[model samples]
Target chain A: AQSVTQPDIHITVSEGASLELRCNYSYGATPYLFWYVQSPGQGLQLLLKYFSGDTLVQGIKGFEAEFKRSQSSFNLRKPSVHWSDAAEYFCAVVGAGGTSYGKLTFGQGTILTVHP
Target chain B: EPEVTQTPSHQVTQMGQEVILRCVPISNHLYFYWYRQILGQKVEFLVSFYNNEISEKSEIFDDQFSVERPDGSNFTLKIRSTKLEDSAMYFCATNRQFADTQYFGPGTRLTVL
Candidate 1:
């Protein structure tokens, strides 16, 4: 089975401040990781995804996440937070093979709040 | 860019009634999926469809839940009997074959009373 854990339930940061949201996953095979954002009452918007290659992967809206196999983490990072960046962030892992194909296990989620 | 689309932004139904949610996946995508998020929970995968049949599904997708690709671009999910617990925002997503990124629709808020 695959699972994701987002340690932070809520994070508040002032505009222009740096932000980091932690995500950890448990998977036996190569983990296909992704980050998604959802505003209130909206569907998920893909932030980025990591299948393989560079540990550092950049996403839309100036967000990026680093896949750290040693720690089983794929934490999202942003150098400057904008007010519009506030939303709920989720980290998900896709199952490797067999019946698990195309299945995604998501984290509880972390709500990001950007302040002025 | 083409994106996934779902109809009926909101639907209200009685507890014992059946409900159908529709989605129109991207024209060239080969995989379609349904997911739901309760008011305060994480997004949960319901089922996935490919080649006119279900390729995968989660435990939440039980006998009461069913999916179909009746046409080239339309994918639909039907819940036999609605439960209050089924109230959630349902989302439709699509991705190209062998692709890791899935694009999601605006979502339909299903409210069962």
Candidate 2:
């Protein structure tokens, strides 16, 4: 079965501190991974996605994620945390095979809190 | 910078009532999808629509759930019989093509009593 797991339920970081949110996936083949953020009362916004090639992919809002195939992990990272960056982050994966067709499997999201 | 858009930011209905949720995807997008997030739960995929038909659906998309692209600019999801468990945030998403990143709309919050 294809699934995504966000190990952390909640994470807090002081402003200017670095942040890392863990994500792990279970899939039979090379996976298409994505990171999305949902602010309160807002839609899920795509931060970044990894389809192929580079292991480290840069995203919007100074966010980046690295896809480690051997580890089945695609952890998201940020050099510095901002109070505005505090939101719910979700990790999702497309199913294996041709034309996955937007049927994304999402992980239980991690709530990020950045304290100023 | 086109984004998917959904109507009626919030809806309140009684159980057993039928409800239709509407969405207008980015004009050029070719794939459309519906997902629901129950309060405090993970977002779950409902169905994917492409080329006027459903391409895929999850187990949660039961017989009571149906999706349609009635015309050129609008897509819709209809729940035949709403239940208390049906209360959730329904999001509409669109992508330009297969395997492309999908853009989501501000979700519609459905509250069933």
Candidate 3:
């Protein structure tokens, strides 16, 4: 079955520290990966997406992710964490084969807490 | 930038009552979708609509759940009978085309009593 895994349920980082959130996916074919952020009581906002080419993709709010085909991982990274950056992050994948239809399979989200 | 919009930021409905959640997707988008996120859970896909018909739907979308475009620019999801388990945040999203980026609305919080 096509699925996404977010290993961490919660992460804590101090302001000005670097942060990394892990994400892995299982699919038969090349996958379309996306990272979304959801603030409290707000809708999910697209942070970045990787469709094809350029394994390293840059996203808004100084976020970036690298897609590793060999490991089937698309992990998000940030060089510096800010108090406002604390939120829930989700990793999702779109199956590209016959069963795929633009529907996203999301993993259990990772919650980030930044202390000032 | 155009963003998807949903009506009634919050709705409280009684059990067995029918409720319709309305949305206006981004104009010029060809694909529309509805998803729900139960509190403290991952967002789950409900259904996708294109060309005035459903392109795909998850198992959770059963006989009780229906989606309609009704007219231009408006998409709606109707649940025939509400249940306590039905309480969740419903989000409406749209994309210009398949395999493209999707923009989501603020979401409607449905509370079934």
Candidate 4:
């Protein structure tokens, strides 16, 4: 079984301030990690994904996340957040192998609120 | 990014009524999936379809729920009897291959009253 935990329930940051959202996962095999964002009334958009290679992966809207295998984490980071960046973020992991690979287990989610 | 579209951006149905949600991929895709998010919960996987049959499904995907690629293009999920708990944002997603990044539709907000 695979699961993701997002420690922060909600985070508020002023415009131009740095932001980090924590995400940890439990998986026995190589973790196929992903970050998704959902704005009000919008669908979940893929922010970034990590299958292998670089530990740090960049995503759309200037967001990035680092896959730390040692810590079993893939935390999202942004040097500066814009007011429009306010949205709900989710971290997900796909379990390993077989026909069972398509299901993506998601975190509880973290709501990011950007202030002026 | 892969593209997918879902119909009935919002659907309102009376409890016990049947509701069908549709998903259409821009191009041909072998894998199609359905997921849902309750008001304040994580996005949960419902089921996945491939090669005209279900490849995988979660526990939440019960007997009342069904999926099919009836026309070889439009993939759909049909809930036999709507319950209050079935009210949520149901999303349709598709990917090119196994372990591939899935592209999600804007979703259909199904409200069962």
Which pairs in model 1 have colliding backbones? none
Q: How high is each candidate's TM-score?
A: 0.97, 0.97, 0.98, 0.97
Q: Sort by lDDT, best first.
A: 3, 2, 4, 1
* Candidate that would win on DockQ: 4
- What overall lDDT goes with each candidate model? 0.92, 0.93, 0.94, 0.92
lDDT of 4 by residue, B1-113 (tens): 55788999999999999999998975856788899999998899999988888988999999999999888889899999999999999999898888788889999999999
If both were scored by lDDT, which would come out higher, candidate 2 or candidate 3? 3
TM-score of chain B of 3: 0.99
Candidate 3 stretches greater than 4 Å from native: none
True contacts kept of 4: 0.78
Give candidate 2's error at residue B47 in angstroms. Answer: 0.4
Best by TM-score: 3
Query: How does the DockQ of candidate 1 come out?
Result: 0.71
Candidate 2, residues A1-116: lDDT per residue as tens digits? 68999999999999999999999999888788999999998999999999999999999999999999999999999999999999999999986476566588999999999889
- Candidate 3 residue-wise lDDT, B19-40, digit = tens: 9999999989999999999999
Q: Is candidate 1 or candidate 3 better by DockQ?
A: 3
Question: For residues B4-83, could you state the per-residue lDDT of candidate 1 as single tens digits?
Answer: 88989999999989999999998988888899999999999998888888888888999999999876768999999999
TM-score of 4: 0.97
Q: Residue B52, candidate 4: how far off, in angstroms?
A: 0.9
Clashes found in each candidate (C-alpha, N, C closer than 3 A): 0, 0, 0, 0
Worst 10 residues of 2 chain A by lDDT: A94-103
lDDT of 1 by residue, A1-116 (tens): 88999999999999999999999999888889999999998889999999999999999999999999999999999999999999999999986555576777899999999999
Question: lDDT score of model 2?
Answer: 0.93
